[model samples]
Target: MVHITRGLATALLGFAEEAEPESFSTGLGTTPAREFEVDLGCPPETPIFTHFYHPDAGGSVSAVFGMDFSTPAGRTHGRFVSHPQGRLAVAITDDLHATMLVAVPPWGIDELAAFDRRGARQPLEIVEAEPPLETL
Candidate 1:
C-alpha cells in the first residue's frame, strides 16, 4: 500500500483543479477530459482492483488501495497504487467506505505545505506549475 499523506492529498487537488486538461492514450482508449471520482468501500488488509479515470493522464487505470477494518474508522492511513502512477486524496466517509480523488499522471507528490486541517478540510501545499506526466 502507498502512503497517502494529507499534504499529498492537498497538492493533488490543487494540480487537478488548476492544471489545464491534456489527453493521453490508454490500452482501451482515450480517458475522460475531466476529473474522476471513486468510492472505495474496502475492508482493511483486503486487496482489490479499482479503476480511476484521469483527465490529464487520459485513460482509465486500475490500482489497489485498502485498509484494515480493526478500528471504527477502518484505517486512518492507507495507500493507493495506479498504473501511470498517481496519488490518492482520500476522505474517510465511514467505517468501511472512503471517497478518493485520484491525481493521475502529469502529477506527483513533489512537496508539502502547511494549511488548516479543521473540521472536514485537509491541509495542502501549493505548487506554481503542474507536475510532469507519467507514462503507461
Candidate 2:
C-alpha cells in the first residue's frame, strides 16, 4: 500500500490516490469504481517505460497485477477500488506482468533512487519544487 501526495506526481510518473467526491455516489449506498485504462498512449503491446507518467490520476492505492489474465478483456481491465476515509487500494497479483507500482509523496529523490532496479547507480537528478500559486 503506497501512500502519496499530489505534489510528487510528475517525478514518479505515478498518481496519488485520493478520496472521491460525494458527487460520485451511486445512490445505493455504494460507490462505483472509476474505470482506468492503462494506456500509456502507445500501442498496447509496446514496451512501457519502467518509469513514466500515467495518463490519468490514479486511485489511493493502485494495484500492479501480473499479465496472467485468462482473456484479452481481462488484461485490459483496470479500476480504482475506493476505500473509507478517502483512501484507495491497488492489489498486485503478479510481479512478472505488473512490474512497477509507484506512488508519489513528499519523498526525497535520494530515497527513491535507492529503489531503482537499474544497477547503474546513476547520479540522482532533483527537480526544484514549484512555489504554490497565490490565490486571487
Cα-based lDDT for every prediction: 0.29, 0.25
Over 30-56, each residue of candidate 1 has an lDDT whose tens digit, in order, gives 112121133233233322212222332
What is residue 44's positional error in candidate 2, in angstroms?
32
Q: Could you give candidate 2's per-residue lDDT for residues 29-98 as a string of tens digits?
A: 1111111142223333432222122323232233345332323232321211222232112223212122
Provide TM-scores for the models. 0.20, 0.21
Tell me how candidate 2 scores on lDDT: 0.25
In Å, residue 110's CA in model 2 sits off its true spot by 3.2
- Model 1 misplaced stretches (Cα beyond 4 Å): 23-101, 104-136
- Model 1: which ten-residue window has the lowest total lDDT? 23-32
